[model samples]
Target: MTDHGPTREELPFPDYDHLPITGLAHRIRSLDLAQLRVVIEYEEAHARRVPALQVLQTRASELEAGAEPSGGDPSALAPELSPAPSAGSSVSPATAPGPDIPPTESDEAKPPMRG
Candidate 1:
């Protein structure tokens, strides 16, 4: 059998910043043993501040001990800010997908001949 390795979903890294403290905490109260090691390493290298590091450590302990940490809904943390795309006149030709070339040439397609 061919090995595809692990998919992105299988990976432990969280996607959005909002997820680290909220969504991810609910999903996995504590990091897995292996993942804890990674978190410690990342925390040491980047965020050495006490409060953030303490939070990670606390979550790590909870995971090791099997307990849930309290946090807000991941969805509730961030408002859905994207505006809907405007209709018709606002649409760009580049974004409109098709085979590109016109199926048939019209009278306007011909250029005037020069003397």
Candidate 2:
């Protein structure tokens, strides 16, 4: 609740306001107690979203219980925001249909395109 550390703008996760509850939960795991406090205070003053507050509080409790913060760059891009792989999708020949598979055909009874 105190303003002892970073403000909302200075939060460990720069995109905190846009993060979903699940993402917030994951990101906060790497924050220490002080950083969590900043998030909690900001949330209380702005959104006051109960779920987000709960997640922050839970992590604070874990830190209070002597759990060390997880290792990661707090300012790193969020997983959802990371650039897609340059190699493209995971789909491969094994996952695609084989050439032998017949393409679907319209019902013969159906009228042909008027255009």
Top model number, lDDT:
2
Clashes of 1: 1
lDDT of every predicted structure (CA atoms)? 0.50, 0.79
Which residue runs does candidate 1 get wrong by more than 4 Å? 1-11, 14-24, 27-30, 66-115
**Tens digit of per-residue lDDT, candidate 1, span 72-110:** 332342333343577768568777778757545675687
| lDDT for each residue of candidate 2 in 1-115, tens digit (9 for 90 to 100) | 3444346666777778778787887788888898888888888878889999988998899899999999997777887565545977879988997688544565555777796
Worst 10 residues of 1 by lDDT: 1-10
**Cα-based RMSD of candidate 1:** 13.4
CA error at residue 52 for candidate 1, angstroms: 2.1
* Cα TM-score of candidate 2: 0.63
